[model samples]
Target: MNQADIVIVGAGAAGLMAARELSKEGKKVLILEARGRIGGRIYPLPKEEWGYEAQGGAEFVHGEAPVSKALLKEAGATLTHPTEWWSVRDGPPSKIERLSPHDLQLEEALKKLTGDTTVAQFLDSNFPAGEHDDLRNFVQSWVEGYDAADIHKASALTLRDEMLDQGSWRQMCIREGYGLLLKYLQDACMQNGVEILLHKAVTAITVNQNGVSIQCSDGLIYQTKRVVVTVPLPVLQTLQFTPPLPKKTQAAAKIGFGGVIKIIIRFKTKWWTGPREQPFERLFFMLSKEPVPTWWTQHPEPHTTLTGWLPGPNAEHVKNHSDEEILTLALLSLSRIFNISIEQLREELATFKIVNWIKDPFARGAYSYSTPESKEAVQELHRPVDNKLYFAGEAICEEDANGTAEAALASGLRVAKEIRESF
Candidate 1:
């Protein structure tokens, strides 16, 4: 048996960060990642692969969290905010940019929320049926756009909590891709003597009073005093935990993992003329009706690539369709939104790509979201199971910060501290 002081399953932000923390105390740690690459959902594809810049997974840092801020500051990473938003609404599709008070409306609506209500309930009670439909759409769009959440299922408390907790409404993106953050963590792990084994998918974990034995699909075994399972929530649901904890199982069912489809389309030329008759001109984002309602450009950085986002129902809707069919849907959405002909779009389209996190066996879905029982479920995950099996991931984070890389990193540190104190 391959023995270690600790075994970390899934080398995403949480596992990698935990390895660094444990290594600081001279704990022998082994990190096994199912994917061939690191950085989990914060993928930054090389230009060689797509002939243009792209972030296949995580795109923005929503706020200035301490963990994220410290790492980013240390990396000498310059954080740049995207430009003003523009829309292509029904009236004439003019290029004139209009100042939108989207945040004000969203904030006012969020302030009225109370109790254990879902987003659907909040919207219905506040907006009614036909009146204030725009207000409803504004909040719903933010829910799907930021949370990648299912409106009917996710807690209203979650949305309210997130908005309340933010120190800044302005979102920041790394001038360099998000991969830089992962690289720093990866280097720290290596320097501290953590052993990282990529492409090692852990199939089963057997734990007893003495310790834990981990079985990998690669036909190897690892024995450790403690194990940190940081795999995605959906993937965790499918894992075989010997003498399973019923609470963990029920908790996993309570918290939700949402579906999302992201597409980065590289165009031959900058399509939006400029900031006027060209609403898309220098536009950071263009939000519209669903199937693919969200699109954003690599603005202020001279790039023609525009990312298309499909979350919640729209993402779930296209799960079984072929690549060609999915591509067509994206293309059609853009064609109608921009008022460009199909032939023109086809000609200008350089390359298109999709990240199938939903269908990926190891991921199973995008990130996690809050359910009514999310707080209790999350607290249960925080407790060490039999002093042998510990859990750390975005899913196990405090209800408010439950779906971010910062949360994952913080949780890793949290569990490592617990393990050390236990000894």
Candidate 2:
């Protein structure tokens, strides 16, 4: 039997951050992870004698969250800001670099969309209920692009409320691998006296007046006074609790994490000739009418290599297919616009990898969102019940929701504070 002051499941951003916070207060914290390595979704790819290749999750410190920025500085991680970054596909990639009033208007619209009502509802109501189909379609495209999901299937209310206020600067990528940052976090946790146990898949959690008992797949029992659950929402749903969660909690879990798939293609040399017909740092847009609508390119890392993105239903469709089939389809899709060939992909493309978070057991899905009928579901998911169990992750963050490393870290710290207040 293992015992600790607080037991954290999942060694990803939320879990690590929670553990770090608790440990800072001198609490004995232990983190159990199913995967052998840390950084649940945030990971680096294989080294083919090139530069930093990212397989799983890879993104830089985003947003103005003090916690995330402070952690980066605490770890001595240096960042390289790209001069030209993030271009949307709707138009010619609006280059209003200095955070203009137009961007703020869009921000207000986003806030109005996500906060009081669903994005779909907000768009519908904003345009006389029957007008502006073209405008609505454009707005939907932008929303889908953000989540890597289709607008119809995602939660409009959740999207409108929680994600709208996050500014444009919230999106950024790391120069090195995202996994490297995870390694730095691991080292920092160790220095802070936090214990991280890998290959520990928590199966069941029982909470009573005494405390919480976590049952693992390996038949190991961990007893602790408090537990912080940082696992993704989908995985949380699959887990069984002794007394069964409340109806609201169950409903919240059913909201489901948005499905996302990222296909990374590393080229021997830069093959893309910039989207704007001009040289820039980052390029993003809807490639075609295919399932994988959006694709983007970033400069080479250490070695000369280019990485592209394929998200949303396009990702779900290709998730189960073979590597060859996926590679073929992706190249074919890109070839349509780029005027490239499959032979070029076979020749110049050094390597390619696919990441489908929905298929991963550790992360059943990417993150959770608010649905049209269930804006309150997200709140239920994050609320800690009985003072014995707490939840933390990108999905549960109240303010800074959506797909950002900062959101995940903020969630961890939030839950840790909850535990501190409870005790």
Candidate 3:
């Protein structure tokens, strides 16, 4: 049995941040993690495998993420912005225009939205079907692909706010991968006397008048005055609570969780940048209507790697497929998009990796998205139970940063402050 002033379950970004903050106040904190390694969804691949600090999950820093920015600055890390964006249809690829001809009309319709509703409902009401098919497709693709959201459940108000907010348009990539930032937080936690135990999957949590007790899969038990759970929403639903948190459980269900499939392929050289009329040398992003519909390059960094993304329903549809099968599909999509033969791509292929977050037991899914009830759901989850049980994660965040690492870090800091205020 282990004892601590507080026990933080799941040593992800949220857990590590909370531990660091609490430890700063001279409180003993123990973080129990299910995975052997840390960083949670912000997974970093081996440098030797990709020649650079390749990210397996959660790559870009979205918008004005204050917490993420501060941490990167503190860690002496820098950010780089992608230079261009392109889209491919039946023929050649062309640069993407940020605003479409329907922008003014869409903005006016969004402004007149009176009540909360699903994105599907809002789009159907405003854009309709026959006349605005292209506009509808664009909006739906953006919601499902980029946000990994179910249009039938994602909140219209949340999407409206995000689309209108110019800050949300700003994106930057970590020069050395997001792993550096996580390492900084981990080091800070350790330096402050916080203990992190890996592969300690918390099975159950019990809270009573005598404080809280945590039981791990290995049968190890922890006794602490307070407990903070920062596990992903799916994992949280599985945890056994002695006094069942029915309201919190229901609130979690009200919020939306989505999945993603990320495929990374490294080639011997930048074949797409070959001497051609339309060179892909400066390609940042490319969108298509293929099985793997989205692709991007590490622009300005000069890496011979291309990343394929399939999110939301598309990812879920093929979540159970084998790695080789998915790789084949990726190749097919690339072949069609570039009008190149699969034989040529295979010849230049150095290595490849597929990241299916939905299949990951620890993660279950990629990230959270807002539904019509998300606001109320987040509020309910944020309410500490008996001042002994606390919850913190990206799902608990209700702001524009809801699905980013910034949400996780900010929630951790908020929970830490809440715990301190209780004392």
RMSD of each: 2.7, 3.9, 1.4
Q: What TM-score goes with each of the models?
A: 0.92, 0.84, 0.97
For candidate 1, list the clashing residue pairs, or say none. Answer: 95-276, 95-277, 95-278
Q: Which stretches of candidate 2 lie over 4 Å from their true place?
A: 47-50, 53-55, 83-115, 123-133, 153-166, 254-256, 273-291, 300-303, 372-375
lDDT for residue 222 in candidate 3, whole number 0-100: 88
Question: Candidate 2 clash total?
Answer: 10
Query: Cα lDDT of all candidates, in order?
Result: 0.80, 0.67, 0.90
User: Which lDDT tens digits does candidate 3 get at residues 7-90?
Assistant: 999888899999999999889899999999999999999998899988889899998899989999999988988878888853
Best by TM-score: 3
- lDDT over C-alpha atoms for residue 215 of model 3: 94
Report the lDDT tens digits of candidate 2 across residue range 156-271.
55454335544544555555556656777777678888998899999999998889999999998999998888777778777888889866356655454566766777778666
Candidate 3 to truth, TM = 0.97
- Backbone N/Cα/C clashes per model: 3, 10, 0
Whole-model alpha-carbon lDDT for candidate 2: 0.67
Q: How well is each residue in 18-71 modelled by candidate 1, as lDDT tens digits?
A: 988899988889998988998787888997865544798877776656787788
Instruction: Report the Cα lDDT for residue 208, model 1.
Output: 81
Error of 3 at 64 (Å): 0.7
